[model samples]
Target: MFNGLSVTEHREGDDLLTAGLGLGGLQSMAPPAFADATAPTAPELRRRAIWSNWRGIADLSPGGGYGSVYGSVANVPGREFSALARLEGARYPHRVLVQVPDAFDHDRRCVVVAPASGSRGVHGAIAVAGAWGLPRGCAVAYTDKGAGTDYFDLDAGQGVSLDGRTAAATAAELAFAPDAPTGSAGVRGVAVKHAHSGDNPEADWGRHVRQAAQFALQALDEAVPQAAPFTFDNTRVIAVGISNGGGAVLRAAELEGDWLDAVVAGEPSIHAGATSLYDYATQAALLMPCALLDASLGPLPQPPHAAQSVPQWTARCASLAAAGLVEGADTATRAASALAQLRATGWTDAALRAGALSVGFDLWRAVSVTYASAYGRYGVGAHPCGFGFAALDPRMAPRAATPAERAAWWSDGSGIPPGAGVGIVDPLMAGPDAIPTDPTFPGLVCLRDLAKGNGGDALRVRAGIEELRAAPPREGLPVVVVHGRDDGLIPLALSSAPYVAMARQAGRDVRFWQVGPAQHFDAFLALPDYGARYVPLLPYVHAALDRVEAYLDGTGTLPANAVIEATPRANGQALEAANLALPR
Candidate 1:
């Protein structure tokens, strides 16, 4: 569907499964069974095998715009075929569809996957889905989150039931197109966004988690309406998301385990529970009291020597307090006094933090403490704000400046200095040179936008894992989790912890795999797309699909090889092996 490129489509009957959809008959190629009960079942492993044959659809045209973005499923040549077949009530099928871009055409019955960001919405995702080599008709379609129309269109095309409670799928079917209306698509589902609410996202963690779940559920409603009804197998779903989508899935699992079966969340985050605006203010107050001392005045040391360095400067402040250069029982009191002075002029933390005064305050130090504290509460006590910033390791945390790093903070020195004292930062505070206006800085903003919109809240969502773990598994259904180590958006380390813990608690029988470093869902991030870092996962997806087919047919065993070595120290060992002594 790429505007400048073209994708070949094919249409055929369901008899193509005999040749194994171009990769050799995997239906008869069974692998050894895994001994570990905590591992994936045979059907799960097989699903991954069948999923690999889908080579993905690519749009290579130039000058294509958003209008070129295509959001439908199609077939591939020399591989598989696709068509809509309505299912009888309560009857599910194991059929699937696949595509090998280099070896097939769109009309071949296999789903044509293409990049959605490039006039190719979910086309690439569909290819990734097909690569699993599901069956002749079973195909994954791409749709817009806002529209929630995938299943609607699919129902019209195939006369399939819209009921989410039923787990029965017919023999299977697939469709493909570019720029399909957000309305109904034949036999295809859609994914929507979920969000939690209540407390301010900046201050309350629970509120954020709920918000994210809402957004994810919205996506699921649109993307996978097949599971809308209440049934055991109806919840056997899989998710592959990036950025906000990544964070949304995590929250969704908490809210609706009924449909969310497996997840590959890249750069996932939850809302922050501990790190809020007040916390930031408290840190600034404790570390850089001078900034709050006088809104009208410059830094206490005048142009606080940037060369003085963060550690040295904070050390100087601490040392000064020790020598009585400043007066107050503790850093907080001293900060409070300074804040009182600033408040007299109605100055807010946002104003000072972005002002020339912030240039003197060491931001790195404050930020490190913030990052460490937030993760610590969740049992991860390491300080990983990145070289000197926060949330660089992914897991949804945003990169932020620490007090030590704030030595470089500067203002354009143009606007009126914000008032003397205020609890939070005013998103609009900046000196004349603050950002030189332009398309970036707005005249007035909220504290949430300045600290890098929703990222902190996203990371905070991890805190909800504890709550999720405490809940009983919905109808004893197993959860499948997949992750790409090379994902820059969601660090492997961040997502690995909770997954391992969840698996450990569930006693295995669940499917958990780590493919090469993949970009959320694409094969490119994974090397060789297999076992190495950044390897493509299409093959594994095929294997997983094979397993799913077996589950539907009652003739499969989970493969040991299905577990692509994720993190070395899986289970609770990593938490126990952590350097910090946890509170029992």
Candidate 2:
């Protein structure tokens, strides 16, 4: 194996290599001088290419199917049953789980569910659809959002394949086959797979979701051929999503408002321009510097060298304070608090655990907390420096750039090195009087002007913010947005509140619900052993969904804008509405 060949290749009657040369003996034999040896084989490269393009993996288990849905076991009790539907389009082919009731009224509606972060592709949408859509005699389709597969695939056509498994049966086979009775209800829906999960430099989050929404519409159109018993009401199709998925749906509503009848965004992480700059900068200052420092200078303070390391971090804090990014008085205090926390718990273990949870934290709560705390400060105005600092800090110093070296790098006016990640500060710095000068912090102006010519970073950041901020809901299109008042991750004030205000200002038919004491994951908490500590907010979520469905069905009225104070039972089963207070 070390020689890149199996023992079988050299075995002669089990003797191995030349006669009587076993695996150990073969090590002593030198290769022929004339033999041509190369690196990776053609087959290996081909295998990698195939794996990279593959979107969904095949599941051959008795009940298993594409995108984590099991046809046999995933069926809801008596009311509804599920089957995997393959939707092939010109650009992409996706498999979604379609759940329909045993029987339904002639005017049944269709729902498209977008899965949340960390959800198991189509499997995650099952519970939400079962509780919300299936009971109403609605045909619900749950989208994977590419959670179980490679979400980064640019070419949507080359998705992973799930073939030849008993559980991998198509929708036509289970629901729309000619032999099946037309009287029995069949599902007409599609699950959309997200293009890219993360902040890919190539594409923004808003653009990716817009494309996914378009793909979903195409998928629904394709479902028409497979759905015989059920006539999919595309005119009344509603999109529902939670968390990151909720943000995607909101973007979809903005980009594809004409295609959607209504949108339900629950605890959405909406990006609202530069409003989050300060908070984002604070997090960068608090979390990033230490990690970068530790990476450069071995394990923070090494015994006798503790004093030497303290000054470097102090300088970073001082820089922020001088720039008026952080409160000058609190700089030392905050550093002390962080250092004390670090000292109480050693770096290695805590860092390892933190690193494990950091992905989820950064994606969900990091920026939220940053915004909350930045605005929470006594009297800090809009400071663009924070945004500048957050972008430049990571690349400001090399792993070997010590405290003294950084000081020189900043002082010499050499600017960021050629290969440093794009700097946004430079363009802002180039404009006369772009960055206000502070008498106390003499270095602020120099730091601001460091990236004078590099405008790419600034342009990207600005464009991203503008793209992410959803356009006001289209006229006559009803939008229902539910936000938890106590949501610490993506605060209601920063995300939904502003968006709601914008929508109302534009006279869009929109309803905003503020549920008190309900955290972001409260609905998921209601599930068995899901979130034991959080008070369940699923009942309120159901209430909001009920309103959305009613409005779509044209049978009921939506409540006026109001704040609902919800009280939860200890068992996470029930949520009581204590009071409904109208927004003043």
Candidate 3:
């Protein structure tokens, strides 16, 4: 339940949809700035936070059809309600925010409850739920689902207020307050809620999603007092989210309730009866670099600035070979062995091919290290792989964050570190500064062993994984799941496909839309070859949402279960509606 609530209404140039930044501002090269870098106001934090979220969550670049196509940032005047929802006796807080556009209809009330994708702040779904629902006068409900940019700075003894400005850790209702930083982590450090909360927060994502919807109804009762009493029975609630957010809605469906009328989940990272993120991410962190060396994959996206980047992934091939993981005397043979091993594990060629993009960014380790700690329920400074988070110095050594940098974390930090200037660190590294080497091979190997081991840490991790699996969603619930064939991060074969099959086999109504030439990340669609080779997945997500909305409204039926063969855009060509291949 909510501990407290704060409300603010937006009018004039400032509106709910874009956080006062219209399409132009959102499409700007940089995010909106804080007036005073060292001492930002709450409103400044909110606006810039929304701007940062828009870029991370949506593809706002020239080709992906944001403003000109499916989405719009047209000012929708509305009142904003923010609150923290927490289980009893917990320091970590999950945010529930409601945006009630002025156009909200009392006669036909609707709410789109979308949890934040990945580990983002409250506005993370503004690109999806906010864009789609606000214009139609439906309130948008967002929850971090127990993960967010509510960073706790151990060095400064500071956390963030609900509005995201820096505040003392001792302050009342700080978003997060981890156990006092201890155990000699070797550098001034920061803590993220998802990894350090010690609560195995993902285990409770379903509860948090339900709480967000509950809060949305309470907020609406106060926002439109004239309408008074708006309960789940009378008001329509459509739940939609992507990635982690998507998994949350699916979890919510498993609960026995009518609070959610329909669900549209895209690339959901749910651990059904198949491969969980931990099972694959650690494998990816260890073998992807070696696998990328296979020339047969052909022009796969390597890490940005590969020619200039350190860590020499070629060293990774050597490391894997030496560890007896892959059988090969040289890089080429080693790469083939790695690719063969991945295929034997049931990974599709498209998934491995698309995964090179994430491999380049080191996202596999980023996700693995974070999730490993979360699953093991490790507190701050106790990462099983010896990983820590901190702002980096010029030489890439961990350092205390500057006031301005600390002030911007709420808006700039990606919920996960290694973003917003704060990076993953190895406190156990012998040198004063950690140097990039062999792409952090030892750490990845350690994580992989934990996955296959049965130690205390492994037991904890597997136990948490068990908690994340979904039972069949309650009968009579309708669900539309959309996943891209090219999604390497959370591969379609490993996640959505099996879950949908099981739910339907249990006699639940679940629609599956597997889209080709589409990938997990719409934001990455702006990249050069990425834009040319892959279609954005969000448009299909929107199509699913539209169809479900019609079904709920009695205007139409749900789309059939089938693959949608979308077309890749030509090089230098603007994305067009014809490329979507959405079912008629």
TM-score of each: 0.33, 0.48, 0.96
Q: Which number leads on lDDT?
A: 3
Which lDDT tens digits does candidate 3 get at residues 456-519?
A: 8888888888888887887888889999998888888888988987897888889999999777
Best by TM-score: 3
Q: What C-alpha lDDT does candidate 3 achieve relative to the native structure?
A: 0.84
For candidate 1, what is the lDDT? 0.29
lDDT of 2 by residue, 1-584 (tens): 00111111112222101122222222232311211122223222212221211111111211111112211112232211122333322122223434434332234536445443222333343333334664465545454433323111111111123311111123312111111122223211111122111221111323333333443344334444355333223434566666555665676667543566677777776665334432332343343333323332234211213355445445555555555544535545544444443333223222322221222233222332222212222111112232211124463321222222221111111111221121222233334444243121222333222222245433433443443456676677777888777564455666787778777787887788787655654323423332322333344445667777777678877756767764443443332233223232
Candidate 1 per-residue lDDT over residues 454-545, each given as its tens digit = 55533453343233222222333433445444433233444543544554575644455555424332322111211122233333444454
Tell me the deviation in Å of residue 135 in model 1: 5.4
> Which regions in candidate 3 have their CA more than 4 angstroms from the true location?
88-91, 181-188, 302-311, 428-439
| lDDT, candidates in the order shown | 0.29, 0.37, 0.84
Total backbone clashes of candidate 1, pairs 3 or more residues apart or in separate chains? 173
Query: Residue 243, candidate 3: how far off, in angstroms?
Result: 0.4
